[model samples]
Target: MTIRLVLAGCGNMGYAMLSGWLKSGKLAPSAVLVVEPNAELRDRAVALGCGSAADAGAIPADAVPDLVVIAVKPQVIRDVTAAYKRFGDGRTTFVSIAAGTPSATFEDILGNRAPVVRCMPNTPAAIGKGMMVVFSNPLVSADAKRFVADLLSASGEVATIDDEGLMDAVTAVSGSGPAYIFHFIEALTVAAEKAGLPAATARLLAMQTVYGAASLAAESREDPAMLRKQVTSPNGTTAAALGVLMGDDRLTNLLTQAVEAARLRSIELGK
Candidate 1:
C-alpha cells in the first residue's frame, strides 16, 4: 500500500527528515504532504515537488494521510493538531518529534483513540546521523510500528521503548548528547590554543581528533576501554591525561550528575 505522510512543520529537523526520506527513495515526493505557515519553508517543500500547504485547512479533505507527523514546537502542538481532527476516528497514526512533550499530550489533542508515537531526535538528524528514541501508545498496530521504524531509519538509528517514562532518560542521553560532544570539542580547541597552537590549527586538530576517535569507536571490534588502554602507554602523555581525568572518578561523577539533572529537567518540562 502507498503510505501518505503529512508533515505539520517544515523547519530544520522536519526539512532534514523530509529530505532524507526523498533522497533514500523510500518515499516519493507525491506521497508526502507538508503544512508549514512560513512561506520560505513551504516554498522549499514545494521545490522538492511535495504537496505543500500554508495551513492544514488548505490540505484536501480526501487526502486522508496514513501518518500525520507533528514536527512543530510543543507549545503550538494543540494549534497545529486541531487541523487534523478530521482523521481522528482511530485510523491514522500520529508521530511527534517535539521534545519534552509526552504521548499523553498528543493523545489529549488528537483524541485518546489516536495512536501516537513520541520521539526525541537530536540535531544530528539534519545530517542523517541522528539517534531517535520512540515510545508509542497501545493503539499502534504492529504493522504501523514497523512502518514508523522504517520511516525513521531514513534519519539514522531508531530505537523503540515500551515504557513512555524512559523518554526522559532518552532525552537526557541522545537528545542532549550532541551538545556535550560539541562542548568537549570547544574545550579541547581552547586548551590546544593555550598550549601555543594557532587558533585555526587548534580547531582543526580538535575537530579531526574527535571525529577520528568517534569513527574508530564505531567501527572497532574492541570495546572503548580496550581502545583507550591501547592508546595509553605505561607512563605516556595519554596516561598522564587519564590520571587527571580519572582521578577520583571526577569526570564520571560529573557526567552522572549532568545526565541526572537533564533527565529531571525533561520530566519537569513534560509535566
Candidate 2:
C-alpha cells in the first residue's frame, strides 16, 4: 500500500520520527504531510520536500490519509485533534504519541468509530534508539496495526500491549526511565570527581561505563542478575558497593517507589 501520513505538530519528537521515516525510506516525502503551526517548523518540514501546512484544514478535502499521527502535547490534543476529525470516515487511523492522554480521549475527540492507537515514546527517539509502547482501541484493524507498527519501527523498538492500562507502567519504566539513567550518570560523575579524579576523566569514565554496560546487557544472552553477580567478586569493591545498594533491598525498594510514583502521576496527567 502507498501509505499517506499526516503528522501534526512538528516538535522535537515529531521531527525525530519524521526524520527517521525519511531516512529509513519507509515513506516518501510526497506521501507525508506535516501540519505545524510554527512558521519556522513548517518551513523546515517543507524544506525536507514534504507537504507542509499550518493547519489540517489546508489538506485538500478530497485527500484521505492512511494515518494521522498526533505528536502534540497533551494540553493541545483537543484543539489539534479537532483539525483532523473530518478524516474519520473509517478510512484513516489516528496514532497519538501524547503522554498521559488515553485512547478514550482520542476516541471522544475523533469519534468512537475512529481507529486510535496510543503510543508513548521517549526522548531517545531523537537518536533513533527510542522504546515505544502502543495500545489500540477495538476500532483499529489488523492491517492498520501493522501499518502503524511499521511506521514506528523507524524510531527504534516498538512493543504492543494488550491492555491500555499497562501503558501507565510502560510510561513509568521506559518513558521516564531514561532521565533516571541520566541522573545516575550525573551522580556517578560527581562521586568520581570527589574521589580526586579530574572532572574530565571522571565524566569519561562514568559515561563510557554506562554506555558499555548497557551495550553488554543488550548483546548478552545472560540475565542482568547473572551479569551483576559475575562482576561482584566475593568481598571485592563491587561487593562493597552492592552492600550499600542491594543491602536490605534498598535499591529495589527505592526504584519500586519511584516507578509507582511516576505511574500515579501519569494517571493524574491523563485526567
Candidate 3:
C-alpha cells in the first residue's frame, strides 16, 4: 500500500531507515515529511527529496500521515511527540525506534486508541544488514503490522514478537550483539599480534577470518556445530583451539552470562 510517512527525527538511524525506504521503493520521497530540529540533519532529509521542517508544529495542519515514526532520542521523545499529537487521532499509526521506551508511553500521550509499534534496531541497520525486531499493541491492525514490517525489511531482516516483555531480551541479543562480535575481533587481532604476525597483517587476518566464518555459517546448509566438526581433524591445530574455547562449554556459558547481564540492564533502564 502507498503510505504517507512522517519522520520525527533525521539522525543516523532515522536517515538510514529513510534511505532504505526510498532505495527499496517502499515509500516515495513526496510521501515523507521529516521534522528535525538540527538544521544539518533536516537538510540531509531534504536532500533525499522528502518534505522537511524545523519542528513538528511547522508541518501543515491538514497533514495526516499513515505512519508517524518517532525516531528521536528517548529523553526528548515526550516533548517531540507531543507536537504531533494532532496526528494521533486514531488514524496515524506511531512507530518508535527509541530503546527502553514502551508502547504504553505512547498510548499515554497519544490516547489509547492510537495504534503503536515499538521496534528494536541495531547499529548494523545503518549498513542495511541489521536485525529489526518489532512488537505492536493490540490496537494495530494486521495490515498496519505488515506495512511496518515491509518498511523495516528495507533495512534488513524483520521479526515480530507477540510478547512486549521479551523486548528486553531482544535488545540484549541482536541490539547489542554487534559490540560483542567487534570485541571478539579486537581480541583475535591482539592474539594474532602476540603470535608474531605484523600488526597490519594481524588486523587483516583477524577481520577477514571473522567475516569469512560468519558468511560461511550464514550460508552453509549445515549447522555451526556440524560445520565446526567438518573442519576439525583429531589432534590437529583446530582441535587444540577448540579444546580451549569449548572446554566445559566455557565460551557458551560466558556468552549466556553476558546476554543476561545486558537483558537485566535493559529492564532496569526501561523502569
- Give lDDT for model 2: 0.92
Worst 10 residues of 1 by lDDT: 1-10
Cα error of candidate 1 at position 24, Å: 0.3
As for model 1, its CA RMSD to the true structure in angstroms is: 1.3
For model 3, the stretches where C-alpha displacement exceeds 4 angstroms are: 1-3
Please write out the lDDT profile of model 3 over residues 153-225, one tens digit for every residue.
9999999999999999999999999999999999999999999999999999999999999989989999999
- What is candidate 2's CA lDDT for residue 71? 93
Q: What does candidate 2 score on TM?
A: 0.98
Model 3 worst lDDT window (10 residues): 1-10
Looking at model 2, the pairs that clash are none
**Candidate 2 lDDT score at position 39:** 95
Residue 118's lDDT in candidate 3: 98
Q: Model 1, 28-47: lDDT tens per residue?
A: 99889899999999999999
Q: In terms of TM-score, how similar is model 3 to the real structure?
A: 0.97
